[model samples]
Target: MSTDTSTAAAAGTQPGGGTAVQGHPGRLKPRASRPRRGPASYATVSAVAVFVLAFLAPFLIILVNAFKTSADYRSHGTLSLPSSWNWGILQDVWQRVDFTQKLLNSVETSLGVVVIAVVLALFNGYALGIGRIRWRTAFLVFFLGVNVLPQEGLVYPVYYLFKELGLYDSKLGYTLLVGVTYSAFGTYLLSSVYASFPRELIEAASLDGAGRWTILWRVILPMSWPTLSVMCIFFFVWSWNEFLYPLVLLISNENQTVPLGLAGMQGQYTSDPTAMSAAALLGVIPMVVFFLLFQRSLTRGLTAGAVK
Candidate 1:
């Protein structure tokens, strides 16, 4: 009995206070301690916090001031909270600017651009990346150059070109112009993505009697949908926020977009800051709501292509 007790004590007294498992010679090792965070980690966290605060500051200011009256804005200053929550200002601004029509116009233009641009980009990407067209590098470089060309420089030419085509000052003209311009970058982006697509899959599809179009529609598009979705979101948002082109091209108030509508609120001599803030807030709401709705898709699409 004493010998058995001594044997058990010896087995339990292993290195690092580990205990021997019953029916097994191996001992259970102690858990490792977590590493302490150094100053660098804290500094990184602090920098991220600062950036978040900076990004949120303007929106917070806008929110607070949107609820303030002109008198309250002047008295309490920009950062202070409003004495009363003036919900009527939003409605007032909406009615004053004919925002409902502007909202519809913006939505129409943005969606049109997304459809035209995504289709254009997909075709371009397939031809360049899969077709392996001659002068592909040169074509890509040209697209890059076009994307970098300032809109300011092209404004006059575009205006003249559209004027000649009898499309100037029309929503269709604006949509087509922006869509083509945006498609340059999209083409460049998607071509690179398509280049990395699996040749094995393409060959497999072909062996199964799939033509190029069939493969593109059935195989390539299915795999590439995530990237395409991301591009759609980007195109929509960018087109929605377009100001310079819309300002130059859209002459009729009936065809003007949200950004244009927002700009029209500012008077030459006596602009109401509070009302401007309210207008700004209204302009931002649609985009915010859009992002929220597509937030999951955006996140998934962004990471989908990263792995393969």
Candidate 2:
């Protein structure tokens, strides 16, 4: 009887007593929520940071060293700030390097290259990208073949050909060569961009009694501004930075573009670090400025209509 009473009390106490055990669902732990940083977002930020550092670091090195004397420059790390600023170096560079003339030449060459290349590329790319023709495959393959042909192999042939045609050592010759060399790849790049544009827009333009040339100029060119801007920057950069062709073709220092001018500076001073640094800095300044100005177009314009 006593045992039965104890058992009943134990059973009753299980639910009410603080230390009593009872079968109950374990209190669900509020799961600690994982912080959200979606993979793509993280990747994008990382890529941008990397790109910025890669571009800025070299230019920063130039800026820092541009102010240092040869002794200080040699002793210090390339990235280190100068011990003392020398504004006179820049002044000397400007006067001695004929920087004004060289800069103007570069501007003219780059602008001419950009304009001529893009104009021809627009027509050719539009035709090839949108136009259906029997020889389209053959023509594209041929252009690609031209692109693939070793540039070195072509240089001698081009030099000889230009000499025969009375085109060597002339600005006109350089402009023409740059334009032609660029067209094949420009056409190829623009073709990809043109392909992604809305077909319906083209059809509508065609239905409105527009001729192919008119449609291309009026509709296609305007719509392709993003890619066109990108191409302009690209061509300008390439023409400005071109060393080999300018070195080979430009016989006269007076006709020399900035890259050639920089090379000439090297010989003029026999590797005087101060002058060389100044010339190097001066040569790169315009391009760096141009790049910064067009940074928005290059990044934004690349993806303008890509999604839909």
Q: Return the top candidate by TM-score.
A: 1
C-alpha-based local distance difference test score of model 1? 0.92
Per-residue lDDT of 258-292 in model 2, one digit per residue for the tens? 88877776664367666777788988778779989
Estimate candidate 1's RMSD in Å.
3.5
Which ten contiguous residues of candidate 1 have the minimum total lDDT?
13-22
TM-score for each of the candidates: 0.92, 0.79
What does each candidate score in C-alpha RMSD?
3.5, 10.1
Compared to the true structure, candidate 2 yields what TM-score?
A: 0.79
Clashes per model (N, Cα, C within 3 A): 0, 0
